[model samples]
Target: MLRYLFLTVTTLAIVGCSNEQPQALGTLEWDRINARAIASEAIVEIYAAEGDQLEKGQQILKLDTLLQQAKVAQLEANVSVAQWQLEKLRAGYRTERVTAAEAALNAATSDRVTKDRTYQRQLELRAKNLNSQNDVDSADNRYQSSVANEKKASEELHALRAGYRTEEIEQAQAQLTAADAALRYGKLLLSRYIVTAERAGRLDSLPFKLGDKPPTSAIISTLLAGDTPWARVYLPEPWLSQVAIGDEVSIKIDGRETTLNGRIRYIASQASFTPYYAMAEDNRARLSYIAEIDLLDSDAQTLPVGIPLQMVKP
Candidate 1:
């Protein structure tokens, strides 16, 4: 009879120790969130409102892009001019230009020949005492000047017929490349004027209205990603040692018919008092560590933020 009583007592102790009931007390939260603007500009248009569901890369707001657009336009014109210059260099001199250069060279040569003959005649006349030494000297100077001019015109004509030099064409190509890069950079800057969602999520708020200028570091809106919903639960000092990261737990949400499964993603290293204003000092002093639980099911993401959740030992 005493053995039977001992067995009953042992069974009761085992059952009581094995079962740990969980209390419902946590709020749904977002682990992935988007906030703040990449740059500062006056708000021009608001494409999204509070509580609007948005897809990744969806346009959220537009900043005043008048100046940016104008800058892009100017860069585009510069690129066009650079391209035309490069093409002109590649095409070399036109047929008409070559012909004109050749004609100038011929004229210069004829002038030089005429001046040489006149100088020779002047020298012969001076030798015979028919002209003064000053006349011969003046004619010689004119002949020398014509010779220099003729050489210059000949070189110009040769250059025109030979086409542009390799170095000249390369320099023009470099200028065109620089212009293209500048245009691309200008367009990239202009794209920043339109704010888009970085990920799929629901927009929470827009702090500024249209025409309001916000600082670059200021948050324009807050977004909560529509993935696995995380729950922030407080574990009392007594339960702190029992919880750890990666431990699975059963979650029951208030007003929900089904329970969800989750894993412990984080546990605060330090304990703090629960922020309960209405509670007495003694109750608030009860230290609890904040533990974050990530819901495992994709369907559970539909749970709204701020909804209460309960954690149970599985």
Candidate 2:
């Protein structure tokens, strides 16, 4: 009979052991979230309104560049001129230009020769008493004038053959460089006028309108990055020891439980003031340590930021 009583007790004990439950040390409720505003070098011309969904690299603002556009046009024209100059310098003057200059030089040379002959004839006539001294002097002046004309024409021909001067090419090249930079600056300014979504996310505000000047360093707009959103949890001093980095925890939201892989990414070494909204029902003005629970890829987008959560602390 004693053996039967012992067997019955053993069976009941085994049943009780089978029904035993696991206990959680504590729980972390709610995720803390803050708004992140977009910033850039461009003037914020909002193409999309507050709450507008945006894709990455979409242009939302533009800067004024009429002056720069004109500058670009002027530079293009100068480039054509520079190209012509470079080509002319490399190939020498065109055949037609050189031919015309050569013709002028030849005409001048012929005139000089004819005048010299006339002067010589006049002098001989004077010596033979067949011409006046005034006539000889006039022929001599005419010959001198023709000689000067020939020299001038020869110099012009040489200049034409030289193409553009070294200094002129250098100056044009400099202008081209400056004009390029100016156009780039204008385009940059145009970029400044327009703002774009740097990352794919939700736009939160349009504080500054299309023409309104937004205060520098002030919140013009906000964006909440969709992918990789994390739930920040504040663990109490007593419960923190149970939760460490890389510990798996179970989180329940709206009665649906999901395993949130917690990476002890951030542990506030020093305790900070508890976020006002994080006021626990049992604790007031609690000094708490902050930790981040990374959401799983499937639940990342659906996880509500600052949602009151129940984390079954291990």
Candidate 3:
């Protein structure tokens, strides 16, 4: 009878131990996001403070934009000038200029005719021994000069009538397009001077205060992203095969009586151990796989991060 009682007690204790669920220890955490400065400009205004709940696209801070705005204005002026130049090219030469060219051509032709007549008269006189060789040479030179002037004027008139060349017009258009693109880029850079929140979350920190100049690409703000916190737990090798992503689990906070509901969201492919080369059976048991469990309850959103918790497998 004494032996049977001892056996029965041993059986009950073993059964109770087997019924206890396996638990993994972890801490509550939130996804962190950083907002960086696009330029090394002084912070002029702060729209949101640390710990403030922020909405997506909400203004977080403003950097000094005076210089950027001036640059944009200069680009705008260049765009305008380019536009005018393109318009001028497309319109071709003005009517008044064409008329002037025509008039110049006619005047040059009249002068050339007059000089030719004088040269012919001088040559005839020289042939009759009435004029010296020097006189004939001077008249010949004047006639040649007038002929060159007439040819130049005629070409100028023809160019005016033909208007701008196709290549010239295309070059002007390309310049305008380039200017417009530059202006658009300047405006985009100007917009970056005002920093805004990229996601809806609680503002965790503001590294720069008002009037503080932050270097380019420096983190200006930090946010704890997501509505609810997640549990960062390590799954022992023994339970690695039992749990998977999307599996439901129970979460017990260290100081809370009520348990929270969660679902496994991620599990590391590699196991984490102090010494990677340890292949002994005892060392293999020490390997733990990193995993993340997302809280499903709305109240979990208000929970503070870094609080100890236990994830109990269901």
Candidate 4:
């Protein structure tokens, strides 16, 4: 009876210890970054191959930029034209144009004086019966037309001397500004044809071959980004309260003899169905919360993703 009691007590104690430190099972993962095509352009050149390490701003591949370059050139020309127009408006009329307008006013004034003198002589002749009524009417019409022409010429000269209106200058300036903005946008769009790494990472894939044209927004490259892989584990519902973000834990890999250190970076707020790898006979029916633990050791950087690992409770 004494031996039976000792064996039973030992078995219970072992079971209690196992329940206190349940292992959370999961796979290693790295943050993935996908570079997408901005346009349906043929891949002309590839600077980096798959499995190569890339730094931020490093060229990965080049797409056909002929079309985009042409567009940018057109925009640049438009900007130049707009700039010239604005400058012309701001500078007002040229010296030669002002001189012509002044000359026109003077000629109109001289013609009006001649017409006035002719009309007065016709009126005096009609009053003395030397000229007919028709002659006086014709003379009056000529004089009035000349006066209108002179007034028009004077206004034209005045306008030339007054320079451009405030509204006209502002409109020209706005056109130039719009053209410049369009040019800047075109240049930016052109740069997108050359694929470059936005972050330092390992180039995991090149989805398109050289000379292949990809659809717009299609994935052109995939990168495994981050300095180290993180442990993506599922915590059993029962143990969810025991662990929290910022808590340090031990990471055990399948073939690695030494364990790695990790910190809990995130834990899902809701519970989910237990994944196959994390499901055990006792916890098969229980839901689990997804958690991500960032590997703290620099050596973990070399670890491949999707390798099964266990999170040992601290």
| Candidate with best lDDT | 4
Model 2: per-residue lDDT, tens digit, 282-304?
Answer: 34465777766665546546554
lDDT by residue (1-314, candidate 4, tens digit) is 99999999999976875575445899999889998998999999999999999999999999999999999999999999999998998889999999999999999999999999999999999889998999999999999999999999999999999999999999989999999999999999899989999899999999899999999999999989998999899887777778889999999998899999999999999988878767655556668899999999999988887899998865
lDDT of 1 by residue, 1-314 (tens): 99999999999976775563424267888854545655677998999998999999999998888877898999999999999988988898999999999899999999999999999999999999999999999999999999999999999998988889999989989998999999999898788778788888888778899999999878887888856788888776667667779998888887878888899988899877665631243365556778898889887877788887767743
The best candidate in terms of TM-score: 4
**Model 2 alpha-carbon miss at residue 245, Å:** 9.9
Badly placed stretches (over 4 Å) of model 2 are 1-49, 59-103, 122-145, 215-219, 230-260, 264-314
lDDT of 3 by residue, 197-270 (tens): 88999999998899999999999999898878999887767788788899999999877899999999999999
- Pick out the ten consecutive residues of candidate 1 with the lowest summed lDDT: 277-286
Rank order (by lDDT, best first):
4, 3, 1, 2
- Per candidate, the number of residue pairs that clash is 0, 8, 0, 0
**Using Cα atoms with residue i matched to residue i, what is each candidate's TM-score against the true structure?**
0.68, 0.51, 0.75, 0.85
After superposition, the stretches of candidate 4 with alpha carbons farther than 4 Å from their true spots are 1-23, 272-276, 280-287
Tell me the TM-score of model 3. Answer: 0.75
Alpha carbon lDDT of each predicted model = 0.83, 0.64, 0.88, 0.91
